[model samples]
Target: MSQSNQQRIWQVVSQIPKGKIASYGQVAAQAGIPQAARLVGNVLRKLPEGSKLPWHRVVNSQRKISFPIGSPAYQEQRQRLLAEGVVFNKETIAINHLAWSS
Candidate 1:
């Protein structure tokens, strides 16, 4: 993706509240580029360490963390969400109950 598009993705991500989670597709749509969910993931993956953006506040459309199980990324994501009081049902979250209302 272009730098502008990536910036737009980051901008949308930054708006996600601390206790809320947004799907990749929802972030893409909010950034005005529908169907760019994978692109959003890519941009998020490339974010520099120590970046202030709330990258952890994103998940897949299934309300599941995108990182592989047992991976450090997966653990970190789950830990962060848990710290924010987000409840999970196995690998998936309750999307209807916790999805952010823009």
Candidate 2:
């Protein structure tokens, strides 16, 4: 993706408040790149180490972490969300209650 597109995705992600989440597709749409959900994931995956962007706040459309269950990445994402007061029901987040509308 172009730098501008990546920046747009990052900016939108940064706006997702603590305790709220957005789908990859939702982040793409909010960045004005409709139909580019995978692009959002790619951009997030490339974020630099120690970056302040809330990459963990973006999940699959089902509101589940995209990392394989039981993986370190999955655990980290779940932990971060939980720390932010996001509730999960089993492996899926309570999206209706925690989705970021913006």
Model 2 regions lying over 4 Å from their true place: 1-3, 95-102
TM-score of 2: 0.89
Q: Which digits, one per residue and each the tens of the lDDT, describe model 2 over residues 13-99?
A: 999988789999999999999999999999999889999999999999998999999999999999999888888877878654645
Report the lDDT tens digits of candidate 1 across residue range 25-99.
999999989989999999999999999999989999988999998799999998988888888777776544655
User: Residue 68, candidate 2: how far off, in angstroms?
Assistant: 0.4
Model 1, residue 80: distance off in Å is 0.4
How accurate locally, in lDDT, is each candidate?
A: 0.89, 0.89
TM-score of each: 0.88, 0.89
RMSD of 2: 4.4
